[model samples]
Target: MVAITEMTNWAVDLIDVRKTYGKAIQALRGVNIQVGRGEIFGLLGPNGAGKSTLVKIMMTVVRPTQALGTILGRPLGHRGKLAATGYLPENHSFPGYLTGAKLLDYYAALSKVPRSVRGPRAGELLERLGLSRWGSTRIDKYSKGMLQRLGIAQALMNEPELVVLDEPTDGLDPVGRRDVRNLLLDLKQRGNTVFLNSHLLSELEMVCDRVSILVNGLVARQGTLSELTERTVEYEITCVSDVASLAGKLLRLGATVAGPVVTLPGHDIAKVNEAVDCLRSANVAIHAITPKRVGLEDILVEAMGGQDAKPSATPPTSPPAARPAGPHGDS
Candidate 1:
């Protein structure tokens, strides 16, 4: 178990959280997670890893067998703090009879937002989410992607300081996903803390400031992306000439040769230099030398004990956008 340390700067602090069903099915063993204020934190795990259960516990939607911590600096289940928080649950079911605008107003009212504040906020969020033209359209008339967008808009109706989203981009296409990523960044710019739970590792890699990997209800790993991937740094050298001939020499220098490429694990520059020198001595032409850090998918695979667990479908790549720097200056 990872030791839990109390920190006052956290927007969400969870300690020793556990949940069980019918005394036999342990959904969560013991989990500790901390999210800094004004940052985007991601929660990722394989199916039945208690990701949704944990989120529900945080949102006061499901009762936990044991839990201790604070949300927004207040004790668990604090009414005022909960009112200040926003949440969008997984597989949400909204009333289809209500129009998009009416739905936002209804949700905001439930959060105790003033009637006057609800209208303007609803309009602003509708426009922000690209639903201005569909404001009066009934939710049943909206597409799956549009409903997902409306769900996110309703969560922000109260202008929460801490937003907990479960699969916010589940039904979104490439463009919709890109828009959601931008919206998340905009929330961070406004000093809002976001706790994101999703199965899409690529999307999380693009936006999360830090992440926690859970396995069988336990936290297998947790930290900033840099912290988690630091040990996974490796260098790949592609050669025009066959690398088989130099395998024996490169092996002595802690490098593996396969076909026309040499793989060197770790960040040892001297080893790479020696390998290059060995290849040069053999008159092998070098095509490219690339450095890489293992991605979130790689980390998740390792956490799952090398099992062949598939994450959600990866969306098409889009142009990179400017992102906020994480604690380690990487995002």
Candidate 2:
């Protein structure tokens, strides 16, 4: 039996979900993920990490070897439930012969959108997506960015409660990306759930309420952005004069000297003062001192077992105050 959590309206609730391809290519290995209602959740990983497979399973495009969960509070693969869900797959293809407006109308019809509402909704979405002038133009002539925006519009054509996008911003420039980000926030404000799969960590960091980093078909880490990132805080101090010579003295003050930059634990204000005092005593030129926050990318790289992660001077503490009470998360 699936465990019922406090989040009764979970957008996604899966337990020990597993998928395998052929006999040896295991795409997912009993993974667990829960996305809350109306949340902008992100899934990130390098290529071949089963991110796409996960999405496909959710969309019922791929049948999992084993899955025990509910989507939108309904049994997985319930066709009727799909009307309330929207999906924008990676590299989406639209009919080249149809005009942008007709394209949306066609999809709306497929979703059984009311004929009366389809026309106005299509126009509204085109205007909202900055494609109002191109509505009459054939999709074949639309640029890659335009096509991407249209893909989002088509996904929204049915006013779905849950929107799943795989690399939604794959072809957009900076401005286009910003527009999509703003649009995502707007959707969140409207109380729609968004499940995003993207390789762009920075973009996810900017918009996601929570994220999961999947590696080798397993979820390495998953939690709220702040919960995953705020592990250790360090204060950075830059000194140009004889930093190498003062390394020993700085170490004595609970500071680590990395070239001319000295990092002191953020919790220790006394060490910061002591570092300054020592620098002043040695006639050192202090350039800057700032808190060095742990970013999401840093944590992800560390989770991926990359070599760039810096070792903490202090021993690690208990894992972040138990990811905010809600549906179960990756342990």
Candidate 3:
């Protein structure tokens, strides 16, 4: 295990982390990620990727058998840091017989919250998370949204600096999803770092300060949403005049003209100017020029695969099917 003192930053850091299940089952391969304090970092990958494995390691639910990393400035699995870090697993299984208040109290104890402060804090969390009314209800009766809220409350019981959430809004309705998104924003405002492991590209795009995308157990890309997907679209110059002559000229200049629009692709200023010069010389009447911007999902698809990209027309209320299973399995 690496020493916690090795890292200068007190934020989360994973250096050359690797994990494997058996001789052939490799879960992570040289995975490295760094997140600054008070930043929302997103872990993105298709099903069967190593996002969950990384989160599990961070939470100490499963030890990294081969690789080493640290969380909240302490070596991962360091008991001292566990109290300062909170985790919400993707599939949580709390004692169904316990009331919401009791469940949170149990977690508070496990997190080593002072006995005197535990009860009051539990009540405060229940009220803040919109579960005060249901605090007396048994966990077995709680709806999915209610349970998710309680899960968040439990994770926040220790006033942790790093909150790791896996699919926080997986089964939520539109309103519920929005509420959880707002909760994440609230956490950010309070200067807490959220390490969110989710496949919901749109949601991550909305909230994440930075994102790391993994493929085949390796980090394919990592950066802020803007840096990863930033690109200038092909300038669309719509004209009203006949483009037959103009098309020929554009083709000679290595440009493509279709119908009334001439596509000046690439981000080369000189190339765009040359194409514009050719069009102007042909007496083409330019009616409109539009530069389309690519969305985060667009860039994700380009980097990962077309199959993982969510259809734009599909409503957010209905999430798309899981990404097709890769060789290792669905993440």
Candidate 4:
């Protein structure tokens, strides 16, 4: 059952969403997510974490057991709002007989974009996505990277306010991935909301303004990259001279010594300074000192390991307050 609430400024707001596949298999436990307008929000998780199930529910492709929220300021599955949104599924299949331009035209038409606008829009999107030369080429003749690019172009044909993409760079090479990253930033600049579902941690880290990590059908962590990685995990000091002889003394100071490196666990600046002083007094040649923080991969691994154990660093703070709508109007 879904309860329609008053319209909101959020591009996507889901609350207590749940789904059950059979009599016993629970695909999604209670899950809640909020995406601000005009931001690139990334969804991440290991396989079987219900990431796809949540996205399908948002797109109305799968019925939820219980849900409440708004998408684009209207109730879920609202036709007008649906028309204003675009989606690219995980393994989308398009007709092989259609040319690249034709496919874009078809998708745009389905989105109710005016016939007069489709042609110019198709051409512009093809060029923007590096498919101008392949506009007239049959999709069957396109390479995997080209097909992926075409799929992205199709998703933007309507100039949608909200674009939901699942694995947008699934088949692209490094350069292609970089291009997609740039394109996502461009969309944010145009005040468009993007909900990205992908397994590529480094890519998400670079592009996403905020992210949510789902583990075992629940959101284990959700926040901006800086908020999530605010705590310094450790400090590493690299020295030109071997420090293996000082292992016992360094260990006594809550640091570990290996070869020419001295590692101080946790965010203790005083301890790090003490180690540095010790090395300096010993006439050790220090090369560099670096502080390390937990990244997205580290967060994901910790989430998957469950919250029972003590985390290596402080947990992320709560998500920030709702942001105002962008220039594109209420999301």
Clash number for each model: 0, 0, 4, 0
Candidate 3 lDDT over 216-247, as tens digits, reads 77888889876775565445555666687767
* lDDT scores of the candidates, listed in order: 0.86, 0.83, 0.78, 0.85
Among the numbered candidates, top TM-score falls to 4
Error of 4 at 185 (Å): 0.8
lDDT of 4 by residue, 97-142 (tens): 9999999999999989999999999999999999999999999999
- lDDT ranking, high to low: 1, 4, 2, 3
lDDT of 1 by residue, 77-99 (tens): 88998888999999888999999
**Deviating ranges (above 4 Å) for candidate 1:** 1-7, 240-248, 283-285, 307-331
**Which of candidates 2 and 4 is the stronger one according to lDDT?**
4
Q: What is the lDDT of residue 82 in candidate 2?
A: 83
Among all candidates shown, the one with the greatest lDDT:
1
TM-scores, each model vs. reference: 0.87, 0.85, 0.81, 0.89
- Runs in model 2 with CA error above 4 Å? 1-7, 239-248, 254-260, 265-270, 280-288, 310-331
Residue 162 Cα positional deviation in candidate 4, in Å, after optimal superposition: 1.0
TM-score of 3: 0.81
Instruction: Give candidate 4 misplaced runs (Cα > 4 Å).
Output: 1-7, 306-331
